[model samples]
Every structure is written in C-alpha cells, then in structure tokens.
Target: MNVNHSNITITESACKIADEICLPDTYLPRVVVIGGGFAGLALVEKLKHKEVQVVLIDKNNFHQFQPLFYQVATSALEPDSIVFPFRKQINGYKNVLFRLAEVEEIQPSTNTIITNKGNVHFDYLVLATGTTTNFFGMDSVESHSLGMKDIRDSLNIRHMMLQNLEQAAITCDDKERDALTNFVIVGGGPAGVEMAGALAEFCKYILPKDYPEYPSSIMNIYLIEAVGELLGAMSDKASSKTLKYLKDLKVKVLFNESVSDYDGSLVTTKSGKTILAKNLIWTAGVKGQFPKGIDEKHVVRGNRLKTNFFLMVEGYKNIFAIGDIAALISKDTPKGHPQVAQAAIQQGKWLGNSLLKIIKDKPVKPFEYKDKGSLATVGKRKAVADLGKFKFAGYFAWLLWSIVHLLSISGFRNRLMVGFNWAVSYFTYEKSNRLIIRNFKPKSLVNETEE
Candidate 1:
C-alpha cells in the first residue's frame, strides 16, 4: 500500500487509539523525542522536513538557555531574552510538531509512552530528558535551597535575594539583617562560579546605588566547593585565574567544603563550619531524569541509561538516549560524555543524521564527541578560556565568552535583547529591571502552607 505520508493531515489521519494522543497518521517513521533541551532540539532541527514525523514533547513550551541562567538569577539578563518558544522554533518546519506534556512512564514492550495528558506510540524513541538537581538525600538542604537547573529556579533566586535584601532594610536585628544579606552558593562548577560572579557584580555595581542606606560591603557573597579547585574540568591556568578573579571581586571562596544542611537562614558545612545565609543556591550536582520502565541492568551510575557507541540504549532496538540522561560509557568516555550542551548537541545531530540509515539497516558511523574547549566568566571583563592547547584569561577571554554565548542563543530577538542589555551594562554597569513579579517562598514554607 503506497500511501502519501507527506500530505497526511490531522483530519484525514486522526489517531484512532482510545485516549491516545491525537497525531497525524503517517506511513513515515515517527520519532518521538522526550525533551526539548539542546539535544532534542538539535535532533528535531536535523529531522525537520525529512521523511519522518518528529514529535517533540517537553514539560515546558519554551527552550531555556541554561548557560545564562545565572545572568537571569542575578538580574543581568531578563528571562524572556534567554528563552524561546518551541512553536516559534518550529514555525516553518512542516514535519515537526510540539506537545506540552510531562511524561510519566515508558512502556517499551508496547512501544508507547504514557504522559499526564495521554499516551503516545512511537516507531523510534529518544530520551533527552536531561538531568535534575541531585540533593544526595539532603532533605533539609533541598527544602531550603534553590537549584540552578531551569528558568524558574533563577527567578526564585532573584526574588529571594531581592526580598531578603528588602527585609534586611526593614529589620532592626543585626543577626537577622546579616543572614538576609549574605548569600551562600554551593558548587565550584560553571553554574555556581558564574552565579557567584554575577552576584558579586551586583553587590559591587548595583547594591550601593539601589540601597544607599547600607554600605556596599553589607552584602557578603560566599562560594563553597567540595573540591580543592574551581572548574575541575578546565585547565589549571583557567582555574587559578578564575580564583584570582573571584578574589578580586571579594567573593569569599571556600574550598574543600561541602554543605551538610540548610535551615533557610543557616548553612552548616560537613567540616562543622556554619554560615549565616538566607539565600542558598545549589549547583553542586545533577542526576539523570527520565520516565521509568527501562531495565535496571541498562542503568549505570548517576541514574543514566547506558548506551552503545551508536547512542542506542542497550537491550532495545529502537530506543535511544542522549544528553545528560544518556551514559555512553566506553574506554574513552569512562563517565560518559560530559553533561554539557556541546556534547548533547553533537549527540543529537549525530543521531538525527544516522537514524534513517539505522532504520534501513545501512552502515552508520559510531558517535564521536569533539571537545570544543571550556569558557567561564567572572564578573565583567574577567574570564577564562581553554581552547585546545591554548589557555588564556582576562578581557579577551571575556569578550570571546560574550560572543560565543550571544551567537548561541536561539532566536534573533533574544540575541538582540541580550546583546543590547550587555552593551548598556558594559558602559553604565546597569542590569535589567529587577521586579518581583510574584512572591517566592522556600520549599519548606510552601509545604507548611499546604499543610
């Protein structure tokens, strides 16, 4: 039966399964991707207009630029400037579709996925669900701290910092004021480093102007890391330079420290050290997130799905994994590829280009990751970059960082807005409007309210 898959429409080819998601019936292969992050989006872009129907499912309708999330957290950039709607991204792609749904489970035997809204059947399935903050069973810290994994977390940090600052001005108790103004950011990775840098900049440039009643030094910023050095993945030169940069900004860097607990106003470290900080941001760790149903044998450390060189999940024919949720463990990649955007994007592009060949039983090359170096910035005009054998730090590195991130943004409008904001801030040292749109409460308080 030779059917024209390209001309299929919703009305002409309605899904007949009871309670199943309504999708166009096409004879062409249907690739269901369970995420809209860098990996999934890159795959979708590669598959657009191809002889396949690509259904992208994500909890949010927009794709968040995660690298700049700290900027949003510290009011350096607005949320809208870093997020682009999926619909807008797939506007002209005729063969692509976007669905807003949270996947609950994956029934591999039936080749179906169960979502909160409905069920979706797939010819091929790709898990790019990414990772969530790993609290390591620390209930108190998880409840009291904010994790920098998404846009909402950024907004929460912003509101928490702003609200706490405002409260500091209103309170008369010295200890309470100190706690409210102090910030403790856990982790020495890129997210934590960038966040600490941005917050330090805010204290340096914006604090005195906005809250003249108090000295600029009133707001203390502390960055805690479990390891001895910052940015362990980068070069030593980059790491040392970064440490110097943060020290120049007066950011208290505490190495060989790990958070033990947080009570929303106090952070206790494993070494019995305690810091009074109402604002706590966690960027320490992340674990893979995906719908349950895969075999435990195929799962590895970090709760990630184990895959072969071809990026196909073991013990499954048409099931694959990518991005942070995937652990393609091998001799070369002992811990799987680094859970960074570049690796995910490359995996997605590789899979997208090779999937059709895979389906047709044709020869395809094994996935190989290319290291494009690492870049991190600390406040304005200070950054670090390790490109191949060349490692550098300072203004040129910062400029390179800005250009790379600006060009990497999804939409032109977003890029323009961010670029314009950066230009204005470069000369004037100003950030966007730090408006508190909604009241943000800690998880403990929210749970208490529910109770």
Candidate 2:
C-alpha cells in the first residue's frame, strides 16, 4: 500500500497534513498506533518483544497518569510525577520506536498511515488516540473553559489557580476577591470530584497557611454535575459516601445542575444561576479520539468505534481499536467499557497475546473486561471505594486508593517521589512544591492544550 500526504489548498495546512498522514502502506506488517496515552502505552509495552515492527506516534512524547492529574492541577503533585517520557519508558523494548507527530488521518484502504512527519505502512493498526473532553459541542464551554485531560492542562490549572489566588490577595474588593477565589468545576466525574476536594483542601487547609492575608473562608469550590449523583459508575453506596465526604470537605455539590455556558469570567448553569469566576474546569463528557478511515456509522456512542469480540473493528480485519477508542459492541456493554486505564491495559495485553496466536494460526480469544473495582478520593483521610461485593469509605478507603495508585504508577522513581509527596502532604496538609513555574492565560490555547 502506498500513501501520499497532500490535500486541496482550500483546507488548512494542518488539516492537509492530517489528510496525507492517514494513508495506508503495503510493506511490512507494521503495527502503528496513534496516541501515546494509557492505551497506546500499554499496547507498546505489551508488544515490546513482538517480531512485528511497531511504531507509536503521538503529538506529545509523554504518557500521562490520568488518575493523579487532579492532584497536579490542585498543587498536590508535580507534572513529572504523573507523566513519564514515552521514549524512556520504551527504551528497553527493541521493537518499539516513539515518534512525536500528530496523526492526521487513517487511510486503511491503502494500508498506509499518514502523520505530520511522513507515512508509515502497517499490517495492524491500533487507534488508541483515547478521548478528549467533550463540552457537548457547546461553543462557549469549548472556548472559555479549562480542561485537565493531560499534563499541559494540569500545568495550566496550576498556573491559573496560583495567579488567581495572587491577584485575589492584592485586592480589597469583596466581589473581585470572591470571584477570584470561587472555583466552578463542571462535571461530577472522578476528575471533577477529586479536583473539587483538592481545591477545597487548598482553600481550607493549605491556602490559609500560604496566603495569610486573605481569609480562606471566602474561598468557595462548586462541583456542578448534570447527573443526580457523583461517581456515577460506582455503586450507590460509594456515591453516597463520596457525596458526604465532599460535603464534609466543604465542596458545594450541585446535583442535576448543568452548565449552560461559560465566558472566561462567569459560569452560567442550566438552572440560570451564574457563577462569577476566572476559572471554569471542564471534566464533563469525553469522546473517543479515533483515527479517520473508519466508517462514521461504526462510530457509536461516546465516539468509540464498534469493535468485535476480538477487539477488531466491525468491518475490518487488519485494523483494531482499543481502550477508550474501542466500543465493544456487545449487549453487555452496549455503550462500551468505561474509559479507564485498566480497560486499556487489558486490551493491550490481550491484543499482544492475540497477535502471537494469530501468527501461529491459532484461535484468538475474545477480550473480556475484568472490573476490578473503582475508587475516588475526597480530601484528607476521606475516600470512597467499590470493590465488587465489598465497599469501603472514609479514611480506610482513602488509604486503599493511595496505595493502589502508588503501585500503579509507571516508573519506580515516580512511585517513590509520589509516595514521599503523599507522606509529606499527609503530615503537613500542605503541598511541598506549590511554586508557580509558568503564568498561564485561558486564551493561550496553543500553549495550554492538554497533551
């Protein structure tokens, strides 16, 4: 298969570049993956010893640990702790090569994949581009809100948060100070809940120590969700426990309250109540970031491509979609599996084993999702957990969540550092490194877009 990277002059250069990069190739049975997120990282790591030539391409070079992204946003952890360099992570693997480029398209018809850098031929393709925050096509939310999907977004949060606090410190005006101190987090997902809790802690426990001039009592954190409860995926017990914990942490929980629109200064809820603030964090819906060439009809709910039992695209054999991008079109998971790291890791490992079996002409085992459990932390000594039959909440649950995350981190050094930070924070109730490294403006889209 031959591919060309060119498009009509009417399209922008980036769009054209993406178009050209989507072509297929005819050479070796190359395994090309898009996106360097959890799913792609899992795939590359699992396929490290495979005989096939594997090329993993992503716009960014690091794989982000999304679970702790909220901590980074709220100054609990550093960016390095949550993100590992992709090349460094896969350096020991001989077959994998990491490329830093945006995949513009996927032209599976020609078996060639086009990227910003050039074209790559693939025998098997995995679209693990993952998902992006979906503001439900709301233009105001899309343009004026902040997203915490990756490292860059976390840094932006850190920057904006610090800047806001500093600006609020100097102001004696009550309205301006209230607006600056007020934080409206859109979405009641784990990210939203976690962020709200962390920010609340900052205001109640941490920020009081840092900014002694301004009263922490004026600082307010609002967690708005269109749904009736938080942690919707978890059990009702977990949800109830989490709600109580958040309330205890002083997070203003807004249930069944949807955000109508957001300007840079104010967040207007669907209930018509307006929240005046400079920061609006969006952790709402997320849609799969699939590569082109697949039929739009195959794209199901959540923007995920419908995949067969073996994780192969419904109408294609050589192509596969995994993680958040793959929608298992089964009655059991009509909408698809939750876009979590565990699901992606399982899919990647299954694909690796399945590929080996396929080369020897063996039957491929169907992918089965094992739901280990779910956990979300509220502030200090407060968390909720759902483990199949067993449920835990409060301090014990928080401890469990901490231990699990520490073990799940990608690198040994990161694990150590994060553990140390957690210990320090647990003891002090203050994040060690709250220094502002960069000044970020919400309008700085090119610089602040999450990787």
Candidate 3:
C-alpha cells in the first residue's frame, strides 16, 4: 500500500508508525497478525468483514498448503497448485492489509513490532508463526540434511533428488552410484512415511522410464525412527497396516534406531550399522518459531509459548498465540493440541471470533480441538486411516485419503489440477512433470559471494 507521508514516531524508543507499513488511523482496535499459515489464514477469514483493522505480515507473499508439499517434492503435483497468493485471498476486505516483511522483534513495552521495513503499532497482537525444522542441536544434520518446511525447502529436496539421479546414471564407481541412489529419511511420523512412499514410487516407476541406465534395484530407501514403531500417535492397527504397506514397497523400515551421525557421505546408526547416503531428508520434528521479546520462561516444551484456556499468551492479555506456537493446557488436553492443520484452523477461527466478542464485551468460550481423523498413504492403492476407533487400510483408504487432501487444498483450480494429476498417475503408473525448473547446487559449490 502506497502512503504519502514517511515514518511517524509513536514513542521514545525504536517503535514508530510507518505510514507505508501501518494502515490509516482508525478508531477501531488494530490487530496485527504475524505469519500466514493455516492458523493465520483461518483467523483472517473470520475477521474479514468485522470491525477491526487487520494487518498480516509474512516473509512470503503466499499461503502454502503444507500437507501436499511432499507431492511437489516427488514431482506428483506442481508448486503453484499448493500455493495461494495472499493479496487475492483478502482482496475484498478493505480493513485487512498484507505486508511482505520479516518481523525482527516484538517490543511489548510500546505495543509495536520492529520489522525489517519499519515499526508498526498494534492494540492487539497474534502470533501464528507456526513451526520450523528442529535439528535437535545436531549441527551436522542441520548443515548437511535437506528439509521440507516451505516451498523453497521442498524444491531444494526435489532438485537435489533429481540431480543425484542424473549423477548416478553416468557414474562408473558402484559405491558412488549406490551413495547417490541411497535415500535415508529420519523420523517415522507422517512426514517421514509420506516422503518414503513418494520416493519409493519415483524409484519404482519414474526412474526406469526416465533413466534406463540405472536399474531400480540399485536404488534403496530407508526409514529410521528412534521409537519402536511408526506413527506413534495413531492407533496400533493403523500404524501396523501402514508399516506393512511400506514394507511391501521394499522400503527398509528400521525401528528403535536413531542416526548417530552423518558426515555428508556416510550414515552411522546407533545400532552400529553404516549406510552410504548422499540424500538424508530430515522429517524428524518441528518446533514453534517466533520473533524476540517473548520471555524464555513462557516458552514451554516443543518450543511453544504457554497460553491460557482463552489462547492469551502467558503473563500478557493483549498478546495471543495460536496454532503450533501455542501450548494451551486443559484438564482434557494436559499438553497443547496436536500440531495439525485442523487444530490450527480451529484455534484461529475461535480466537478471531473471541477477539470480536472481547471488543463487544460479550461472552467468549474456551478453545477446544476435535480430531476429525488422520490418514497417510504408502503407495499405489495402499494407505491407512484412523477415525476414532475405526481403523482401515488399502484401496478404499487411499480413495478417502485423496478426497480429504483434494478438499484441504486452498484453491479450486489447485484441487482440480491435483485430482487430474492423481488420475493420470493412477492409470499409467507414471509422473507427468519431472522437469527441474531451476538447477540447484550445494552451498559448497556456490561461493559465499554469489549466495
């Protein structure tokens, strides 16, 4: 948004109301929301026509449907299908303004946010900063392994996977080719299992057709979990079925094993086993990410900020945190709700309406999460789903999985395109798009000056 004036200092400190960043002065309470993930989008949707000034700040200009990122990495779906522009999302809402800036810090003293652009004051603040890949203090893993948090992260893995296959196709050394083809995925949760399934499908169908030189037998996929089983949160029947489906695809499932170390080329396991691996995808865990000014004391387990039943940040009433960043403890949920899209969206809608109720001095209810269900696909016509006590696996489960994902996607165009792509793949057993648009080189290859 273009402004005629420059920055206007609101207080004595660094806080200033920059005309370019902040909206026009209004009598209504201005709510500044940080982050544009599932939770932030849900909140904005609820407060679009309400009597509040909403300003959303995110580093990226779009809202990404994260659950389908694995499909993008596997060449099953295009990136544009999973990404939605923020401006188009709230074009009709005059009270809401979108800002593409990174928040540097939150100065609660002045009720302002210090961003890379300038300062912006807010009567109420909501942090939905979501989660980031947690290496768990493993520096080597942080530097060497690839992550899949956002579009850029997912694309990096895609480029690296295709590049490795290209390198393996022409390599003379057997060991070198094996290292290039050997894919190791850490953490046996939904992300790990889904990635392994996608990669296995690519190895099974795409590789043989695209690169005839390298046999599919040379390619290996490993899924290592620190726990004794996969999908620890799901029912035992669902986990067992998913595990069996993965094994049927020839994926090496290592339970009760953790990766001790990975030195760029070799993976050393705690179980004294060594595997040559060049691509190690870490889907292990994620923790809440936010700007400064929140006291470390309020930060609880899983990097979440402790919140009251009403989703207000601990020790502060105006500042609130929802989604993965909030740790709301109740008698039912001893810990916070699960870090899923459903929980995040539900909390966002609840808080948005609650904030309106607060403005009107009306009744506001406590936030609660209802788990609709959880589903994960292993490979073609193979999946497992759990809805309360009901657990099932196989083709019908896969159909349910596809329908759920299709509905969850942001845009109708994206949903239609993804459905079409899935149909093509199902009938022919092949991936349509495998073109690497931008070539990716490791940081070791790209000089720091260029970077």
Candidate 4:
C-alpha cells in the first residue's frame, strides 16, 4: 500500500522480520504511541510533518468524548455524535500513521512492542494507554454492574435501562417491577453526578410519554457516594448547588455510603443498607491501563507509571508515559496531576514540543501544568463551574459547560450533531432515538452461558 501526502510517498516493503508489523521503510526515527487518547492524539498533532515517523496504536478505531458519556447512557445523545474516527483525525497528516491493535507487552530491552497483530520496533515508545474502571477487587459488583469508561458501556447502560423498563411493564409482581425501575449509580464524582441527574430527567419527562403504564414516580433514581458531598474535586458551593439540582429533579442522594456488593438486582451498601435495582452504573474510580513489561518498582498507586519532571518513565531512557497512566510524582503534585482531559492535553503538547529537543540531546525545561479550572453539569440548565476565584452555578454555568464540551469534540460534524441535539432538547424535552439495537447481558451471566 502507498500512502501519499504532499511530496512524500510511503510504500510498504518486505524488508523487515517475517513476524513484524508491516510499515513503510523510513530512515527517520520511529516514535510509537500506544493508546490514541487525549494525550496521545495531542502528541501526534505536534509531531505531524516533523522529523519523526509517528505511529499511533490503539485498540479502538475512534476517539470517544468521555464527558458526554452520561448523556449517551441516558439516551440524551446518540453514540456517533460523541465519537470521532481516528483515520478521519489523521487524514492529511502524512507523517502520522494509526494502527488498530491491542498492545499486549513491551520489550523495553529490545525497544519493541508486541501487539495482538504483530511486533513493532520503535526509536521512542510512548505509553498513553489511559485508564479502565476500577472495581477495587469486588468481583460481584464488577460483573453485575455497568461502567462508564467506554462508549460501549454507555450503550450497554442504555439498552439495559430500556430492557428493564420493558420488563417492568410486563411483570405482575410489584417487587420485581420496583427492582427493574430503580437505578443505583455509584460514586459522587462528575460522571456519577451527571448520570444521576440525567436519569432523573428521563424519569421525569421521557418515562411518562414512552411508558405510561406506570407512573413516572415508579422509577427511583439513587446516587450513592462514599463521601458526604458531590463533586468532591470541586468547590463546596458547587457541590451544594449540584445536590440541590439533583434534589429538585427528585433524585435520592445517599451520602456517606458505598456499595459493598451487587448481585444483578440487589445493591448492598457498606453501611448495611440495601437497595433493589437491576440497573447499577459504576463510575466510582479508574486505574491506569498499559501493556505489561514495566518494572513494578516504577508503578505507583492506581497502577500509574512513575515519571520524572520530563514525563520520562523512571529508570527508562527511551520509554515515556503520559496522560492518566503517567504519574509525575513531586512534592507539589504528590498524587500526580488530575486525571482530566486538559491535564492530558497539556502533557501531550508539552512532551511533543520538547521530545525532538530531548532526542537531539538538547536542553529542555521540565513540564509545568497549568490549572484551567473545572466544570460539571447536573441536568439541563444546571451546572457548576470553578474558574479560579470565580465560582458559580446555574444557567450560565450550564451554558459554559455545553459550549466547552461541544467545541472540545474532535470533528466539526460531531460538534454540529451535539449542538443540534442540545438545541432541540432545550426547546422540547425530547431526546434522540432510544432504539434498543442489541441485547445487553451482564458479564457474569454471559460468562456462565459461554462456559
């Protein structure tokens, strides 16, 4: 295959090892980036058309807008509106190439990465594999409940909610109906808060029109947090306002409680409280995910790679880590940087700009992270923002959240779709098509069936 860009043409040749992944022969330094998340993509953008040959490898073919995942889960937006294709993102960037493969291991000694497809050698390897849902050793909850880590998780939640509603309508037993209608969202972070708010909105508006057999009051929306507050990362005022917004929407907020076990229908809390609910969305926490091969000594809490000020993995020369997976341990940032998109983007851009200098043995300054503020929305027209000294919540904050997220999306078409959906929902409380395209089964049940 021949890939052309401007005056450059890359042609694949049979000049590599028989088991090696095919790539066009190039004398330039090969920089292989694993995981096409925010940081990886940003680095690729900076390295495009530069001296290095950039190769981006990811398990998925698209970049998902994670902040809007709650909207997708609650059927407020379609999946495609929030996801952009990787190939589309790198359309004209000739120096950058995207490969779809799950990296399994990294042989740092050989400067090579082994993927499910084949092995690929790199001059400099970047680990931006990001994070996965952290169940914290709870096998029951992990298998029974859904997580909000990926686009597929959102779809699964949607289908499960819809299917449960349908089942609730058909069941003659009141207890079974209640279990089917109740929703228990774990964690008090932005994802869980937004998800609870959206579910409350759905129970208010959509449920009445779509399923009129039972009253909207039949659906119970519950937000369970281990702490006494919501949006613990935000200001106290923001947390109070978010709680108020959720209360106004008739959501039951359970503070100072965490889930101990979930058996597909019953959610038992650590405080000995139990709630019957088939739909449980776990947004509690996330731990770093990367290919095996790094030394255990360099791995920190949350399974993140310990890095120096330059974002280079500790004790490694050519291997680096970025995004959520990189923990730059310092006295100021003892827990590393916040696992947010802005932090990841800044790290990527900084590394991208400084990488070439480092490669040439030139002096480069350490990475400095700038706090860009935080924003989280509850339901429609209700959000909280903390922009330095300016802390506020309400319609203006919601508008800012909408604008920021809409513009942050990768493709212009995706932005348009999301904006249009928001506009329509603003006027009429209508959501996108809630079509149950496939059957969603719990992980444990699926495993049992497969076995």
Candidate 3 residue pairs in backbone clash: none
Off by over 4 Å in 1: 1-6, 11-18
Q: Between 3 and 4, whose lDDT is larger?
A: 4
| lDDT for position 449 in model 4 | 98
- Report the Cα lDDT for residue 123, model 4: 97
Cα lDDT of model 2 by residue, 1-451, tens digit: 1222221122344345643443322233568888777777777777775556678888988888999988988888888887888888988665667778887777878888777787766778888888988888888777777888878888888888899899999988888888888899988989989899899888888887889997788788899989899989988998898888888888889999999888777888878899888788999889877657788878888788998998988888888888888899778987888889889988988887787677557897799999999989988899998998999898989999999999989899999999999999989887857788777766646446764
Lowest summed lDDT across 10 adjacent residues in model 1 is found at 1-10
Q: Rank by lDDT, descending?
A: 1, 4, 3, 2
Candidates 1 and 3, the one with greater TM-score: 1
- lDDT (C-alpha, whole model) for all candidates: 0.93, 0.82, 0.87, 0.93
Candidate 4 lDDT, 2-104, residue by residue in tens: 3234433445554446777877667778899998989999999989878888999999999988899999999999999989999999998888888899999
Using lDDT as the measure, name the better of candidate 1 and candidate 3: 1
What stretches of model 2 exceed 4 Å from their correct place? 1-28, 444-451
Root-mean-square deviation per candidate: 1.7, 6.4, 4.0, 2.2
List the lowest-lDDT window of 10 residues for candidate 2: 1-10
Q: What is candidate 3's lDDT per residue for 267-332, written digit by digit as tens? A: 888889998999999999898899999989999999999999889999887999989999997788
Q: After aligning candidate 1 to the native by TM-score, how far in Å is the CA of 283 from where it should be?
A: 0.6
